[model samples]
Target: MLAITRSLPLRIPTRLFSTTPISLSGHSKWSTIKHDKAKNDAEKNKIANKFSNAIAVATKLGGSDPSHNVRLATAIENAQKNNVLKKVIEQAIKRGAGIGSEKKNVDTALYEGVGPGGVSFVVESLTDNKTRTIGLVRSAFTKAGGSLSPTLYQFDRRGLIVIEKGELTFDDIFEKVIEVGAEDLEEIEGEDFIEIITDPSDTGKIADELKKEFTIKEVGISYIPKEDMLVDISDEDTKIKYDKFIAALEEISDVTDYYSNLKNEE
Candidate 1:
């Protein structure tokens, strides 16, 4: 169902790497309490693992003090929002600060892949082992009838900010975002939130300016797709495969964030 007029440049190795298979069954049965518990536990673990890495990365980038380091503050805020335990958050900070025996060198890497239905993926991961991380990523894509490839050409790197839509309408906020030098603004209907996109280098400064009036919810850089490169998956089979592909990625402990060129499903 996925059609490509031209051959996509592949980044996969000469031979496929092996990883433990991800059972799609874990996803198909969500009605029973037993299944629900398993899924909820997995989701919580994923959230905790991701925020732990994020906190560690932010602390290493700036300092552990949230007041002094905007990035660290954002990471901690997001962790707390997701209900990450206070002790886990503190431990991650200590590890990042090299103040604990658990401290280890952490590195961040980006991976590009083409998923089912020609959707391009950009995965950001923080890990101590690049070899193991790549192997898991590559296996996920392959098992989902996709492959690792050069998909960055189809996307642009940008900063994304989310803030409370408080008292202001979309027009009201658009004016403020433009005045703050953001590149674009989008209203999240029914969510009382607005998203502002900006040049990656300007994210922090713009966020600071906007924070004077708005409650900032999230601040981060993202890989956004070029208009012409967006993929739409209408076929049910391809959709199923894509969902499973995403689930597999979510189960990987090292992956922190992922981006895609898929259009919003209607």
Candidate 2:
């Protein structure tokens, strides 16, 4: 079913499946606490794994020297912000650079698909085994009522820099970024932050420049949807099913980051 909320379109599937129970009412304080904690745990793990993979790729591609390697430097900086422990970052570097006994082969991979509600998605990963990574990614898409495909036509590859607004005005950040190869600037309305977009290859360079002006929150290459679709999950049962589906997707370790065209209730 297709519906419109505000200016965005919502595509609902004809059939839905099993759902985990959840309370949407504000009255369920204890239930909300538990729910929030569980979500936090999921996000924490997801972020940690993503940085670990990024560190691996940076090391593998440009050696372990953060000073000399721009990608490694950015990866290290991003990891530290996510609270990835120093020891863990060092080990990931070692694993990628083959510097110690923990040496292992690792490489970045990506997969694209049409997820539930006709939303497109891209899955990024760093894996020692390509076959294993492919299998897990494909399985996630299938279980989400989606199918994996090679097409990424719905997305654009860009370097994204996330930074806090702090004391700087929008024009202040824009001026700095424009001089440093930024392609676009967007204020995340209502959120005290902004997103800077640049040529994928110029991300590291631009991020370094922005760091001098604002607190860098995140920097990386991503597949952003050219257009976004809002999925109406006003129905409690559908929201639960979607949440459970995403939780399952989050459980896959190799999936460093997954971009979706569907904007749904978290």
For residues 102-151, what per-residue lDDT tens digits would candidate 2 score against the true structure?
A: 67777778888765655566777777889998887788778877788755
Colliding residue pairs in candidate 1 = none
In angstroms, how far off is 183's CA in candidate 1? 1.4
For candidate 2, the C-alpha RMSD (Å) to the true structure equals: 8.0
Candidate 1 segments whose C-alpha is farther than 4 A from its true place? 1-39
Task: Report the poorest 10 consecutive residues by lDDT, candidate 1.
Answer: 4-13
Best by lDDT: 1
* Deviation from native of the Cα of residue 12 in model 2, angstroms: 26
